[model samples]
Target chain A: MVSRAGVDEIRAILDGVRDPEMPALSITDLGIVREIRQEDDTVVVALTPTYSGCPATRVIQDDVVRALHENGIESVRVEVRLAPAWSTDWLTPRGRERLREFGIAPPSGIVDGPVVVSVACPRCGSFATRERSHFGSTPCKALYRCDVCLEPFEYVKPH
Target chain B: MRDSARIEYVLRFGDGALVLAQRLCAWVAHAPVMEEDVAVANVSLDLFGQARMWLSYAGELEGAGRDEDRLAFHRDAREFHNVLLVERPNGDFADTTVRGYFYDLWASLALSELAGSHDERIAAIAQKSRKENAYHLRRSQDWIVRLGDGTQESHARVTRAVDELWRYTGELFIGDDVDAVAVGDGFGFAPEALREPWLERVRATFAQATLDVPPDTWMQRGGKQGVHTEDLGYLLAEMQVLPRSMPEAVW
Candidate 1:
């Protein structure tokens, strides 16, 4: 399946590969696509996991390869990188908007130390929200409830 | 430098993570509250991920054909090198919380040191795991304080859990030849060195919780040498059943 394609074209195709856990965001939008390059006849895509134990990692890898293959270029390698580890800071502006539109609060504020975020309600845009649970349905999310709107939602935890 | 010692040292940490991860998984649908169920499982998942990385590296260091899957699913209880602390049963909410609190306190420091390891791969794994472990440490600490200071019943239960679990804490910092080679060779943390700092935090947390630190007693040891309690035997039986029975089974 080893073939060749322009790096930019390959990147665009990758943007269509949605994260299985968060269907609203692409790998690129999540900033897990660290690099895309060609080496010897294989297109290498460097990926970093948002959480070390994220179950979506394997599915996301398969999706990346399948999406690239569907576009005609074949040989693809999904290299997992752990260093300079993935951060909430890497989430793109568009990804943040997409997360809010999907009723999930995106990570906000500084990432250097402890995350003391004041998460606004994605639905009512109210700041009267409180964390219900530090862990949610997924490893990267925390459950929150908007007091004003009385709606429970997921907040992308700042890591 | 003989790779054997390094491999064994790595297995000690990996096996602890794996065994503890398995123990936490047992709490999935059984935790008292829905939020706790999710919380425990999340921590379990993180440890599982760390176990995979550590075991995969150990396999590579072994220069064997085995990998993370082979090492994890195939090993018997006698072959595991985890300390005794992690294999303790999830007795109650207090028991589980105390067990995790002890480990998190030590892991936060051990991982911080490992993050600077000369072995780059080990360093990377530690660097990545430490960030996640920090949150775990905070949560467990909070639970300890809340339960210890909450009510007469809650305080009594948590105090009893602490007293029962305290003896297991000694094995974490006590080391042998495997540690010597790992630390002497500059690839591992000095286990003995972590005790004071670990205790300092433990004392501070206990003070806030209004719980007394248990007096030292004869410590239980030997899990690192592959001599585990009966609990590990049952744990491995359940964990390895699928892999041992259907080696070729795929999801």
Candidate 2:
């Protein structure tokens, strides 16, 4: 089993990559990094899509390979899994904060958890946004039009 | 509206999804372009996932205790309800595009109406599905126009696919067997009305693509009553074998 420090190191190494749309947020923060396994002479990273069928998968994969190589780690294999599904619930607080700073609202509240407040807009800090469509931008986020800012944004659907 | 009829209806929808999904998977390596392949494959996966949900639900209705695998695999060619369009071989990317565009047009309307069905279960499923179908419809329509208008080769090929597949278009609007149970119990939206809007959408897209809207003449109709084209039988054979052979394997 990989130690906690090893995971921390991996996380640090992964920081080199950011959500291409929301540049401030790292891939790990976006909740795409599902697991990391260390074998005899290799490191294998497993990931779940942000939503079921996000278009950014190829870009993210390339980023993963580039980042791992930059860290002087060879023999790295990235595996993409669909089971158990990925949800916006996986977004970290820092990630959410970063998404807002990037002009895209980070998903708010918990999915499959206790009833929570509705998502707030990162632009004007309003919860008055209305959902326009479920499949938006890339297919992972639902499009919402913020009445306050009169702008459209993507909301990560809770898995 | 016996249990079997319901199961068949569900299977037809599911089978259509699964079959198209298999064809879409073929593009994983040979997509005309890079991004187009991923988008097509992803949409195909969405359809397959929907198929699993519908078939599993059908099994429950059948009370045969069969799951998705049994419904997907154990069934004979005669049992499938999918239209001929999905089973038609993918001759080229244009053929696939035309097929997808045709299906998306129908599915978008079908799911929208189903979202309001009297059956709470189907309605719930439709609600989730309409979202994806809407995306499929939008993306496919966009591509149809792009290909239909793009170049000499694409224009010629896309038009041919549309002409070849146009005969199958009328079958989607028939709403025959579906009328038996789809709206009998409750919130089933009238299937007949959807045809006109679908036609309008088709016309708009075809016009945008500058392609002729072939007359809706001599339409091929049958799948709703379990009658399918020859190609469907072979598709069923390939799709059903693994589940039938294994008997109880879970993956």
Candidate 3:
């Protein structure tokens, strides 16, 4: 039997596991880590994909395992859960700040219905931005150009 | 037989996604602009992911030990159950956009309802896909409006595409015994139900773009039942080459 403390420890280790694509953000901060549990002395971590066909998913899964092993935790299992789909609203406040520091605008705000958001420029904090493209370097982001600063940036889409 | 029907039903979703995903990848380096290239590729990636999920579930239901890759690469053209619309060739930019517009519009409607399906797995996949589908619809819808409302050349191209592709769309709304079985089991709904909403939205968008809506024509059928056009064979040949050549190869 595993104790509750063990589960929290696993969660803490996982919180340090960063996304391979956006290394500035942790998987937990990105809100893909759905659940952490301890069963029979094995730590199980559940993850949800931000987008269906993200190439980094497999890499992230491997990274999680490696990080735990390096931290002296053995018998780790990662499960992908799709029932409660991942959403940008789950990005932690600190995660949002990290995105800004990384030069990508966080999602505009908590949204409903449609995902049309007037993104503020991450670098200059200007609200005068126009969408350059509906897609960007990654599936989770869209290309936006700040009219004020004349700077092109990526915005995390509100999915 | 019920299990067989379920497998068949799920394969439709899988094969449609897989075939269209392949079709869209043709535009990766060839799209009109860099942003469009990335957008098309990103959309294809989403479809590929959805294809993997649907095919994985279909394999589990079949219980014949065939996984997603085996099912995708091993299947012959005659075995694919994707709609004729998806297998249709990606012609010009306008043709590809129009084709995607139709499918995305239908997917937007179908997936929203499927998200509430009685089957938990179906609901989960539908819910996840629905989110992506929304963005896809918005992109295609915006392009349709832009092209149809833009220069005379652009308007003519998209109009011709709509005319060419309209016949293939009727097959999406036709339901059969497999759909009946899925509906009876409470995990599926008739596609015919979405047709009106699809048309309403299409007409509204076409109006905004100043494009004339074409009159309904005799619709194409048979893709859902594994009877595909000549296009699917060539598509399968190109997609299945590596796997067909080396049965045991793995990445």
Candidate 4:
């Protein structure tokens, strides 16, 4: 059985792994890493993708595996689980902050709710922003424009 | 027999998604606007992802040596089980939008019900897929309303597209032996149960768009039973040509 300390070390290693698409945030910050547990001698990392169709999922999984191996962990397994579906609410406070700093509006409101809370512009911090398109640079984002600054930005749509 | 029924049920979902994704991909560079191009492509990618999940799960249930690629590429036209609406040719921008609108509504409702499935795997996939389908429905519905209510020409075009496609929509909710087995097992819902809600929403959307709902006249059927329109053969020929020719090639 692997020690609890070993699991913590593995997690710390994961913390250094950044999302390929959103490099400003770690996978943990994005809430993709569902669990980290030891099965016998192997460290198994369970991950849930942000969206079922998000293309970054496969890349993120590979990064997780590579991150563990580079950290002196030879026996590592990565499992992708779809249960309980991922929610934007899982975005860490730090993750939301990083997204703001990166000029992308973080998701707001409940996953399945119809009420869309107006997203503030990350550029000029203006409340007067409008959606340009439901799709943005990636599958997880929507294109929005700041009326004040005239800057077009991406808003990570709440899943 | 039970496993086969499960596989069939899953394949129905997967095939519908795959064919629709292929149709949507055809619109990538051909959309009327850049924003719409991106939107359609994103929706297509989402359906492709769903197709991968469902087909992969179906392969696992089948327990034969088959996987997603094998089922997707190796199967002939007669073996595919997608609804006829998806495989129809993309007649125009309005036609594509209407097709997507109809399918998205059905898919959204079906996935919502499937989220409550007794099988954990199916429930999980359904839960994940339902979120994406919501976004898809929103996109399609928005375009449909825009075209249906925009102007004389635009409204007329969308109306014609709606009428042309109405017959194909009936096949979506007709249950068969495979559906019966799945419903009995608590892993699936009878497609019949979804029609009322589906039509209600369709009617509301049409009302908002200022478009009349096409009469539910004699509905065309048979895509569910591996019987498809000639269009599916052409679609498969285009989609499967590369894989068929270069069987050993890797992407």
Task: Tell me the tens digit of each residue's lDDT in model 2 across B1-251.
Answer: 55666667777778888878877877877887655765676687778777876787788888868888777777776677787778788789889889999998888888777777766667766666665676677778888998888998899999999899899888777766466565675545555787889888889998999899897589887776667778777766776777677877875
Off by over 4 Å in 4: A112-114
Task: Arrange candidates by DockQ, descending.
Answer: 3, 1, 4, 2
Q: Per-prediction interface RMSD? A: 0.7, 7.1, 0.5, 0.9
In the range B86-125, model 4's lDDT, one tens digit per residue, is 9999999999999999999999999988999998888988
The better-scoring model by DockQ among 2 and 4 is: 4
- Please write out the lDDT profile of model 1 over residues A1-159, one tens digit for every residue: 223457778888988999898899999999999988888888899999888899999999999999988998778889999998888899999999999999999986858966576899999999899999889999888999999999999999888
Per-residue error (Å), model 1, residue A159 = 0.4
In order, candidate lDDTs are 0.91, 0.75, 0.92, 0.90
Stretch of 10 with least lDDT, candidate 1 chain B:
B1-10
**How accurate locally is residue B186 in candidate 2, as Cα lDDT from 0 to 100?**
55
Clash numbers, per candidate: 1, 4, 0, 0
Q: What is the DockQ of each candidate?
A: 0.81, 0.06, 0.87, 0.80
Tens digits of per-residue lDDT for model 3, B1-251: 89999889889998999999999999999999999999999999999999999999999999999999999999998899999999999999999999999999999888888898888898999999999988899999999999999999999999999999999999989999999998899989898898899999999999999999899789999999999999999999999999999998988
Number of the top candidate by lDDT? 3
Over B1-251, each residue of candidate 1 has an lDDT whose tens digit, in order, gives 55998898888889999999999999999998999999999999999999999999999999988899999999999989999999999999999999999999999999998999888888999988998998799889999999998999889999999999999999999989888887887888888999999999999999999999998799899998899889999999999999999999988
Select the stronger candidate by DockQ from 1 and 3. Answer: 3
How does candidate 3 score on lDDT? 0.92
Worst ten in a row by lDDT for model 4 chain B: B1-10
Top candidate (DockQ): 3
